[model samples]
Target: MSVEGKAKEAAGYVKEELYEHGKPPESQKKAQEGRDLRNEGRVEDGKPPKTTKPGTSH
Candidate 1:
């Protein structure tokens, strides 16, 4: 993943860690944005976007 995408994902993780009682919607949104950016980068490199797992949503 690109550096900005990685940083966003890491920030989301840290937010989740700091608010363990309940996950905030903003954190989830940030992580999803990271995933989207990573997929966009992959497509720019002529690769398919990463597939989500069978039981997961992305």
Candidate 2:
């Protein structure tokens, strides 16, 4: 199967697994918050916040 097809199948499997073995609401909320934070540049590569030197730009 193509990469997209495989990804879709994997997503379905994960959804079903989470439904069956879901975490507690608070933990799930915290997890989702972390996801949002990462999306908003709170963390990088599972590490702490990134730092940049003054007068430097990327």
Candidate 3:
């Protein structure tokens, strides 16, 4: 699965629990929007932050 997929899947679980408390975590919205943007190949406006983190050498 893509990063967004993983994020959304995790968010879904949190969202379910949050609803009982009448609150939504920002992660839920961010995850959903990220999924949409990634699907369209326009992540962060095609300009992701520069990073030297391992596993991210593109």
lDDT per model, in order? 0.55, 0.41, 0.42
Off by over 4 Å in 2: 21-58
For TM-score, candidate 1 versus 3, the one ahead is 1
Q: How far is candidate 2 from the true structure (C-alpha RMSD, Å)?
A: 12.7
lDDT of 3 at 54: 21
RMSD over all Cα atoms, model 1:
5.7
| Model 3 misplaced stretches (Cα beyond 4 Å) | 21-58
What is the Å distance of residue 12 in model 3 from its true position? Answer: 1.2
**1-58: candidate 3 lDDT, tens digit per residue:** 3565445445543443444333456645654444443334323234342233222445
Candidate 1, position 35, lDDT: 56
TM-score of every model versus the real structure: 0.53, 0.33, 0.31
Q: What are the runs in model 1 whose C-alpha is more than 4 Å off?
A: 1-22, 54-58
- Find the candidate with the highest lDDT and give its number: 1
**Model 1 agreement with the true structure over 1-58: per-residue lDDT tens digits:** 4666555445544553444333777756655665565566566555587667422545
> Residue-wise lDDT of candidate 2 within 1-58, one digit each (tens)?
2454444444533443344334778655554444344333433233344244312442
